[model samples]
Structures are given as C-alpha cells and as structure tokens.
Target: MSSLKLKRFIKDSFPDNNLIIVSNREPYLHNKSGSNIKVEMPAGGLTSAMDEALRSTGGTWVAWGSGSEDKNNVDDNDRVAVPPGKPSYTLKR
Candidate 1:
C-alpha cells in the first residue's frame, strides 16, 4: 500500500497506541569491514515488506542486534531510529 493509505490505516486502527514489530533479524545491519562501518541489508524480502509498514506508523522494531557494530550505533538508551538517513522508526536492539 502507499504510505498515505498505510498512515491513514494506522492512524485509524491504532490510535493512542504504539506500533511495534519484533523480529528475529533486524532490517538493517552494521558491521566493521576493516576500519569502515558498513551497513548491510538482509538477504530476504522481510525487511522490504516490514520497513514501509513500520515507517508509516513510526513504530518501534525490537530485533536481535546480530551485527558487529550494532552497539556503536545505539544511544545510551539502546534505541536507534532506523532507515539511517531518513529515519522514521525506533529500533530497540
């Protein structure tokens, strides 16, 4: 669905409630390739499917922080807003 429609649906269906998605793997991964931090996309459709839905709702995704550099990205609260440059949701690793 388009983001507009998704947003409207979320706004109507879950008003005053927080939207959260918990998964075994994170949508994005961070690793140290030599000295540079590289962000890697998972090798499946799950990320693509859930990303927009979460983004539309501005939800929180609780997933395993399996990446090597995962700790370096989160705040003191251990939450990282995801999709990097155009962040729209919180990721609690």
Candidate 2:
C-alpha cells in the first residue's frame, strides 16, 4: 500500500518532467473573523523542506488555505480535488 502511494507521488511529482504539489495544507494561512485577522504558522520539517526544495527548483506547491475550511472541496479556479486532510500534488504546466 505504501509503495503504491509512493509510486503515485513520484508520478505526480515528475509527470512530464514537472514538479507540482497539490495538498490540503498551504504553506501559510490567514484567519479572518469579522474585522480581525490572524496568520497561522506553516507546516514543519518535511513540509517546510519540500516548500524550499520546490522553490529552489522552480517547482510548484499546491496547498489549502493552510487553514481554510473549504480546503476539502474542489477549487473551481484550479479544478483540484483535495481531501479534508490530504492534498494532491501534480506537475505544473
């Protein structure tokens, strides 16, 4: 099972020599309530490292609002279907 998932991840990352990330967690987030807004901390370790690597390599990282409630839904703008706690990663065109 784990192997399959890894394979899929690899495919998504290097599909046609493109590196993209589609996840339910964004690197950064902003929380808004009424007139007050707050910024949340980003993911740690692996997530942060991945973000850095992508940036250095000119890859892509697709994540949720990093704290948005609608992250589980498929965004109309990107047409990406993300789960409640998991996101999809694909190569950017």
Candidate 3:
C-alpha cells in the first residue's frame, strides 16, 4: 500500500493521540563529509512509510543513534528536532 493510505489508516487508528515509532535502526544516518555532516536515509519500505507518516502527523521517532555525528545533533536528553528548516518531528536518540 501507499504511504498516503498508511498515513490515513494510522491517523484513523489513533485519533486524538500522537504516534511514536521506536526502532533499533535509525531512519537517518549522519556522516561526516569534510567539515559538514550529511544525513542519509536508508532505502527501505518500512523507513519510507514511517517517514511519510511522521512527516504528515508531526510525530516522534525514537531510535538508538549509532551514527558518528548523532551525538553532535542531539540535546541533553539526546533528542533532536529534525528536517532542519521545517521540523515536523523529534528524533530521540
């Protein structure tokens, strides 16, 4: 099924509540490219679906951050507001 359909289903399934996705593998991987950090999203159906869902619902994604630059982006509690410009979710590492 499409991400739009999944998002709709998720919203319908849990109305008046927030969505939290917890996983061992992080959706984004931060790597050091020279002096800058590059964020990479792995290619996977589940990841894509979750990204779409979170983007649409403005939810929280909780995962273990194993990236080299993950710590650099997080706050005291290891939480970071993602997507830079227009943050739609909180990434809790």
Candidate 4:
C-alpha cells in the first residue's frame, strides 16, 4: 500500500490510540565505536520492514536493548526516542 493509504488506514483504524509494537529484535542498535557511540540497524528483512512501518507512523516499539552501549543512551525510564536526532517514537528497552 501507499504511504497515504497506510496513514489513512491507521487514522481510521486506531484513532486516538498509540500504536505499540513489541518485538525481540531492536530496530536501532547503539554500539561502542571507539570513544563515540554509533547506531546501526540490524541486518534482517523483518527488521527492515518493521523499521519502515515505525518510521512512517509514530508509535512505541518495545524491544530488548541488545547493543554494546544500549544502557548508556536511555533516559531514567529506560526509554529512548528512536531514529536518533529527529525522533518520531519511543523505544522502550
């Protein structure tokens, strides 16, 4: 489906409700790259597909923090706004 149709479907289907996706595979992983931490998206077809969905639509994705520096990037609530700098949704790790 197109982006417009998908968005319309979401608006019509889940009005006023936050979309929450629970998955074992994290979309973005923060690894310790020397002194600076760098984020990397996992390599997988499913992760790629889900990531597109999450990026286009605002929602919370609950997944395991499986990165080298995952613990250091989160707030007090163990949550981080994902897609980095311009965050669209929360990643509850």
Candidate 5:
C-alpha cells in the first residue's frame, strides 16, 4: 500500500490522537564534522515509512540515541524538535 493510504488508515483508525513511534534506532542521525553537524536519514526502515505521516501530523518519535553527537542535540530532557526547519515531531532520546 501507498504511504498516503497508510496515513489515511492510521488517521481513520485513531482520530484525535497523537502518533508515537518507539524504536531502538533513531530515524535521523547527527554527526559533527569540522564545526558543523550533518544530519543523515537512515536508508530504509520503519522510520522511513512513518516519517511522512509524522511530519504531516506532528508527533513524537522515541528512540535510543546512540550517536556520538546525540547528547549535544537534545534538550535537558533529551528531547529534540526534529527536521531542523519547521519541526513537526519531538525526537525523545
């Protein structure tokens, strides 16, 4: 099925509710390089599939951030608003 269809299904299944994704691996990773941080999205996984829907609806993605620069990117509670610009999801580490 298509992503739009899946999104529709999810919305239909759970209206007036927030989408939460819990996983071991983070969808996006941040790597520090030469005083700059490079954001990298995983090639393919559950995160890739649900990213669009989450981006559209705004939600929370909880994951174990094991990246080298993960700690620096998160807030006091280890949560970060993602996508860099126009963030729609909270990445909880």
Candidate 6:
C-alpha cells in the first residue's frame, strides 16, 4: 500500500538516507480482551527485507486505547509518538 509506493519511489529516486517505517500497530497479537490488547510483532519477511535494505533502520510502534490518553514509558531518540493533538507525524531524512 502506502509503504510499497513509498519504497518504490525512494528506491528509484533517492537511495541514500536510510529508511525507517513506524506504524501504529505491529503485525501480530499477543492478547486481546475486554477492549485491552497486547502485541508481539515479529521480524517478518517484509520487515526484515526492509530493514536489510536500509543502511540504518529502526521503527517505533505504539499501543493505545480508543478513549484513553497515552501513558508512554519508552523514550527513544529516534522513536516518536502520535499523541492526541497530532494523530500522525511523518519525517524524512
């Protein structure tokens, strides 16, 4: 989808700066119940391939409730959180 198009464009145009894809949801689920959930995303084939292609790559995934504020505990230099005010944030480097 979006990522595939982006990948194609980047690969054809600018192939320098490493790429990192951060999504709101990881692919797999650890558990889900009572409107609460947990996930354990694996390095699936696509993810691994993307990681391999990018010279320096990483991603930050998030988990939040439908009607709750974010209580983030992890603070990574490259990681970003899409808070309430900003539903999504994008960067290119």
Tens-digit lDDT track for model 3 on 3-32? Answer: 677778888999898999998877787878
Residue 68 of candidate 2: its Cα lDDT?
Answer: 50
The local lDDT score (0 to 100) that residue 26 gets in candidate 5 is 85
Identify the runs in model 2 with alpha carbons over 4 angstroms from their true place: 1-16, 33-39, 69-93
**lDDT at 82 for candidate 3?**
72
**Which has the greatest lDDT?**
1
What C-alpha lDDT, on a 0 to 100 scale, does residue 48 get in candidate 3?
Answer: 77
Task: Give every collision pair in model 1.
Answer: none
Q: Please, what are the lDDT tens digits per residue for candidate 2 over residues 1-93? A: 254565566567777765666766665454565665544546587666565445344445666454453243335563332211443442221
Error of 3 at 85 (Å): 2.7
Task: Give lDDT tens digits, candidate 5, residues 1-93.
Answer: 676777788788889998998888887788887788888787776778777778866789999887778889989999989877768799999
Angstrom error of the Cα, residue 8, model 5: value is: 3.1
What RMSD value applies to candidate 2? Answer: 9.8
Q: How close is candidate 3 to the true structure, as a TM-score?
A: 0.84
The CA lDDT of each predicted structure is 0.89, 0.49, 0.84, 0.86, 0.83, 0.38
Q: In model 2, what is the error at residue 27, expressed in angstroms? A: 1.5
- Our tally of clashes for model 5 stands at 0
Clashes (N, CA, C under 3 Å) per candidate: 0, 5, 0, 0, 0, 0
Clashing pairs in 3: none
